[model samples]
Target: MIDNLIQGVFNGVSTGAVLLLAALGLAIVFGLMGVINMAHGELMMFGAYTTFVVQNIFKSLGEPWSDFYIFAALIAAFIFTAAIGFLLEKGVIRFLYGRPLETLLATWGVSLIMQQFVRSVNWVILAGLLVFSILYFGGVWALQRRPNWDAIKNWAIAVLLPLTLAIAGSMGVFMAQIYKIAVTKPWFGAQNVDVTAPKWLRGGLAIGTLQFPYVRLFIIVLTIACVIGIYLFLEKSPWGLRIRAVMQNRQMSACLGIPTKTVDALTFSIGSGLAGIAGCAVSFLGSVGPNTGQNYIVDTFMVVVVGGVGKLIGSIAAALAIGTTSYLVGSGTFTNIFAGIKPLVDFFTFFATTSMAKVLLFVLIVAFLQYKPAGMFPQKGRSVEL
Candidate 1:
């Protein structure tokens, strides 16, 4: 019984990892501007379609869809989506600031326009355009931030695979040489690991009484690394502090001579970049569609809303908790009476049945808001400063 429960946890982590990225973006956007970016999901959708386009371009040009192309696609998605984010902020969002309801409705319309535009056009053709828009432009935008070595390395690898591969190889060598690092088993499952093999020949592993797929391990580590990286950036770096400052109070920071616009742009880009990474990671699980972002939109929003508005670590915790709970309910290890009403609730039916997982999510967030409205980790001095 313990082993089975442990195995179920392992299954949950992979799903949690993807949610982490999407949730992080949702958290940042809502936390900073108090603007519910209804179109954020569309941004992710753009990223996925952008990736699909990049891969296809490689095919048409007789180039292999190598890691380099993927890296390029990541940059593409970040810029394509982030640029749109910046424009939305400048064109529409900025005007609707402090008006969450209006921003929400306005962005919803924007999202519809974006969706229909993509749905109308062959999303496949637009992917390459998005890629180029991101690459040549993203590189410049990232450099404008005067980022550190890691950020520099990050952007460089997106356009340069040999560099990224070398970095990955170097990390493996470093991890190998480092004195025995004791990898601990989580309370929920065994330690996570990254998959090094290509897709066709990867995964399909079994450990002990439980099957340990390489795919699940890969996702867990990816999610963990992302969460840690963002935390480190926020806690340890000067720029991160500035970014957080802008996130907390944009006007005050701008008044204090912080290049607030630049910070806003960078923060939005980082959020969108995380979305791109999630899209890349999602490809490992299934054939990604142009509208892949739609599937995760509502779920990710649930994570951020429950986690609290502006907190990064909160989003991570919320994602894990929500994902784990959803999985448990799905497995039917235990059932709450509200579970049966999910399908009905989902269809906007008051008494009809809905998907158990989503219903639980809605209930959790509602409960979270009722009890801890500021969130698990609300930004300190938020009210005091305002």
Candidate 2:
């Protein structure tokens, strides 16, 4: 019984780690920007797909390279999703700020488009587009410091136009050849793929009578690192201070010569990158699919809401509480405990199943919100207005 309880707690912590990873990015974006980015999950799917791509690339290299693919995949996932997030904010989200309903609807539409894009677009074309986009954006950024818009435009046309055409032509020819060779290949089809764990992570660690899987341990450690990194970045870094200031009072921050727009773009990018990392972590647990982001979106939002918007500590505490409780209740731990008591046993039995456990958990969260609508850690002082 004691061992079971210990194992349950461990499982709960592992679950919490996964939730925290997924929610961390949402918490940052939602809390700071007050934008309900419905497309956040799709960004996660992008990360998962990025990992899949990296894995395939490594597999083509050789056996030894495959073992190191996960590390490269993590980096690739973050950068790829971060770029997507940056574009998302600059293009769609930037125009719809301060209007929650419209922003939500717009992002929902974006999510649908992203989903369909993955399903319909060929893999090679998608990869070529990603590469082209990165180069195009990088060039634009390099030329952004020009003294005038005209100068920037001239440089872009003279330098970037030819580069774009060359890339497009090459990709077009390469894709045509590949298509001709393997017109019936499933790689060209939109389907789910698996990310196999490295040999080093396949085993479990034993502590006394309890056994812990390395994947779970890795996730927990990764979560801790991410939380710490974010904390340091937000609290100690100059850019983080700017973000906080803007979040607290956007008007005042702009008045102080801080570039609020830049802050928003960077913050949103970081948050989206974190979501990508979450996707990479999740891929270790299951198959990667175009719709993978849909699985964690609701639960992640719940964590952010329950924890308190823009409150890191609150998110951590909420994730742990929700994760542990959900696991315990769903696994019949409480039912087993109350087995000797007739009334309590009846109540526990009804709520012990996985689906019912979620229902009970939702009710509890709703009840908690009624008592504290601002969540576990409400913003204080000037941020209250925001």
- Whose TM-score is greatest here? 2
- The local lDDT score (0 to 100) that residue 346 gets in candidate 2 is 89
Off by over 4 Å in 2: 123-190
lDDT score of residue 38 within candidate 2: 92
Most accurate candidate by lDDT:
2
Tens-place lDDT digits, model 2, residues 1-386:
77777788888888888789878888988877889999999988998888888989999998899888989998999999999999999989999888989989999999999887877665555656776777777777767777675656876768886797689658856876867645323352467889888878898999998899998898889899999999999999999999889888888899999998999999999999998998988888899887899877887888999999999999999988888888988898877776789898889789988789889999999999999999999888855863
Q: If scored against the real structure, what TM-score would every candidate get?
A: 0.70, 0.85
- What TM value does model 2 have? 0.85
What's the distance in Å from true for residue 182, model 1? 58
* lDDT of the candidates, in the order given: 0.68, 0.86
lDDT of 1: 0.68
Q: Write the per-residue lDDT of candidate 1 for residues 48-90, one digit (tens) a residue.
A: 6676667666556653454346567667877777777777776
